[model samples]
Target: MRILSAPLLPLLVTFIPPHVTRAQTTSVVLPFRRTFSLSVSASPIILSLPAQNEPYWLSVALCGAILPYPRFFVSNESDVTLPGPGGVQGSQTGEELNLDEGLITYRAQMSSGGALAIWPSSGAGANWTIDVAAIQDDFPTHRRLSQLPLLGDTSATRALIFSPPFFTRETQEPIFPNYTFQDAIPSVPPIPSSAEPNTTLLLFPTANANATVWLTNSACALTSKLGGVMTTTATRTVYRDSSGWRRQWFVDGLSASTNYTAYVIENNAQVSGPSYLRTKSDSFPCPLAHSIPYCPEVSYAVPLPAPPGSATSYTDDNIPQDIKA
Candidate 1:
């Protein structure tokens, strides 16, 4: 008997599987979003300061858009001083000044409501003028509420004054630093980290509040062996991301899911945070975008089992008997 060999046919289609990444024990996280609610009107300027209020901090973002690292400061006085080394001699990549453009708004504690001016840290000469324009304001606000007498506390306002994109303009003048005001409390908060569990970040309450920030276990609860007291750097850390100041501190070690609190030992003590935060218990696996966590990345066909004693799981029995084998 003789047997004939057949030729194999080529298939027309092919399938490619999607890429899959293995899960890890650690993950990355981002800080909470900050709100810019501070708003004012320019139509009718409020020249006089509020008669019955406390001095507050003011934050300015110089050349906020153009400069690689815009100039900034948070001060309580009308004439504030910019932080970090002054002059072109020793400056970082983003510290260059472009006086003609940029913005300076009371975006922070601007609620105090007063005029603003600033000088470089290097010298006290040529204080720049910060022109803040508001859109709709009362026809005029009496310096004192008593002046409203017969009018009985009434005011008028207009809309669509300036074109759009209202901002602060800074123009330099050859004058010495002038004007002073009482100091006010700042309101910076602590930010959480995603890396090692033994770290904390402090956005100083005041620009110059370079004090120690202790990390202690919750006062209400017993201390966890995983961590103890932690402190910030001796000097202010110039964070590029902000014209404002920021710093990082190391903890002895942080225990997962443990409660802790942070506070400044000096400078500005008003912010006690009576505030506490709890550490996460597990290290989350950070994946790119696993919106559908259970979706499969690869697909395969079910392998048909051969007869109980067959050597392989492959068979052609499903083929019609009329077909060639």
Candidate 2:
């Protein structure tokens, strides 16, 4: 299924099977994740964007908190009954639709009383809305907004964290001759850059001859695959001196604490030795306590307490666990 437009009125989502394709589309799948308790008073529109074609926001996580189970359909639009005005008027709901090379991105909308909160999938989005008792179906979307500054509704509050967004491939690219027998090593810190700091930057790095998978792993075990794809060129790094391939593939859509299987399917024909990977937990900009695959450097932020000109002192209880570890 796929969604095309996100205007305030009649949000048009096409319920197409995964086997079909669409020529007119700009949809991207968002990595399944959570939204921490942050508030933003904007239009009632949620988008699922693939990392490769991410918009200017370039965000990694998202969440939602709705009430009365807004409304969704895989077949009949008229069958949907929303609390307020605004639904498929000119046409019937649940129109059979086909999709594209992109995995899927059907559509959804909110009622006047619905809330929007986001948090990581590891925890609830403040409270999970998608996992409510009223609804019991596994659709394409997850419930994860944790903080809605002034939300007043209460129905689905059990939050749900999610994995990263990705696109299902119709066929795999042919493996390069030089790409064979090489390992795809994942790297980030010990030696870091501004965009890829030792602990903060969420970008994952991996390289193997002409192919690179930023998802992390060991020197010989072949760690794993991270992120769907990046349109930009690969960057070279000398972080390891001369131990492995100098070229690096920085994957943008890496998922935290998730397992991925890596393999090469040349021209969708011959398959080679596949590698499995599991990414770290903590992520950039998320200061929550103890996210999986965590780094000891990150933590929930605390304001500096001592005087401006004084040397600061922090007790063991006040220190972040990761830093203390």
Candidate 3:
């Protein structure tokens, strides 16, 4: 089941306000609103909502007070009934929000109550506050907007933090003929190697070398007959280098705190060792208190006491936890 997941609807997500009480009433400016208290047991938990009379764009706000970095997937899918393994993918209709950062808007007009699926990218069960609203008016397109200024305070302060609006494209070229032993010699040889940051190795036979490589969280089984097919459902091809004669291959573009196994195949037969490598884990961005991977820098937020008759207030917090150094 190779699923090429693509965004179905135009979606935009805003960042959550710091330490806003879930019960705090919004100044009845938006048209429709709904709130729910949930504890996510496993990933891809689908929450159903009652449908509406007319088509309207929906805004989703999530608050994870206890989780370090909670990830969410919101879908108006007609049939997302159960939680699936791995993160949400191949959705015909849905949008994934940033981990821990809690705001998303989707252009949806629910004929009936739609479904929103939520999940954690890297944490155990934790408490979550979910808010959804149907914008009564239709906007031309989808994009993230800052929180509406409903609290009428002229002296209130606001600071905007921006991340790149586009995905970072990384292109990895094959590292060939490094100081590693060659494979495809019809014998299992000791491929002497040393660890390098964000890199791995592959060995191949120069004759039948049209090879492919895969990276996985766990070890993947290998077969002697090289499979000609490059695509597989179970694994993602991080690096694909053809022509086995390239002898020694070095693989790069790895992340820290991940265990990766590299498998090389040519024409349905395993040509190189299913070499395993584990990258060193980097330190968490937050203080030592909430140091786990899932913990966002939520504790660092200090609400500024607003002066009476002030319209705006500021909260001092560290950088976004997702923005690593």
Candidate 4:
């Protein structure tokens, strides 16, 4: 089965501070305010089932935190009633949502099968609210607290993190051939003239094969002579195990408007080809503070076409006996 997910919300507000104050002296006082707010919004929880229908459940990771524990409520806008811990109704009565450690997930079952899910409206605002009086004791004695600043409403910022509704892993069928014997190397993109010192190189490998990938200005020269002039400032490596495929390199503090290249070797053997990439230049005026540096535009290599005559090897098994003879 194929599962696709996308980030439901782009921005997520985590903490909400209430207003508080402390008097330092007869004439002096300090005021404390909430820097951020916590909001939760999710796409309708969905569960798609096969022909043989069976009861299924929807599970989502909950993200938010509060100093004093706050009650959480899950409203089932649908006609069905959701079962909760201790057989409680869909909504829990008090401030039960506490975001201390990291991420928390919640699960709810559907009475009927066939792709059950929830559709929370975008910018619907915070689904849950907290009681300021209940958490007053946990407030800092020295520091003051106040209502969180409102850049936007709570619902406007809360977003789904892990399982976005727009993610898809369907691999595109290769229009070209595969390099069975040849080494598949890494390639980098060009750097713009206005780049930052902390540039990120995104490397996308074809197969989930256990290979050694590196960033070097030297190796790239083998394919393109211009790559040789570039220098290798950093290196990173990733191993493809049973879990999944991923890029292992993240280079920071790089020079601006500089040319760079990346190399990929399968099992220590240098691949026949390498990729060339460059960093953007830093000619534009800096944003915020003049001394603060900005990031540059990054470029990445496109997937190369497979070598010719490789089709026979892959389709050899499907060929007819008469045709093969």
Best by TM-score: 3
Identify the runs in model 1 with alpha carbons over 4 angstroms from their true place. Answer: 1-228, 231-236, 240-243, 268-272, 285-325
lDDT tens digits by residue: candidate 2, 1-325: 8644557223222221111112121222333333223222211122223223211212211113221112222221223321112242222233222211111133433211121211112111233222111111243332221221111111111101111111121323458674544233423343323323111111223334125432121111121222233223222232322222122222324445554443322111112223344444543222222121223222222343331333122324344456557
Per-residue CA lDDT of model 3 for 1-325, tens digit only, reads: 8643455221211122112122121222235555655543433344554456766665555433344444455545446432233423533345555521234566665655555555443433556555555566754112232221111111111111111111122434547765554343222222223211111122223233333222111111122223222221111111112211112122223344554433432222112334444444454221211111223222121333331253222212332344433
Candidate 1's TM-score:
0.18
Model 4 quality (TM-score): 0.21
Identify the candidate with maximal lDDT: 3
**TM-scores, each model vs. reference:** 0.18, 0.17, 0.28, 0.21
Worst 10 residues of 1 by lDDT: 151-160
Task: Order the candidate numbers by lDDT, best to worst.
Answer: 3, 2, 4, 1
State the number of backbone clashes in model 4. Answer: 48
- Where in model 2 is the C-alpha error above 4 Å? 1-60, 63-85, 88-238, 241-325
lDDT of 2 at 175: 82
lDDT of each: 0.22, 0.25, 0.33, 0.24
| Model 2: per-residue Cα lDDT at residue 222 | 20
Query: Per-residue CA lDDT of candidate 1, range 167-238, in tens?
Result: 222323445576444223222333333311221222222212223222121111111211233332222221
Using lDDT as the yardstick, the better of models 1 and 3 is 3
Would you give me the overall lDDT of model 3? 0.33
3 or 4, greater by TM-score: 3
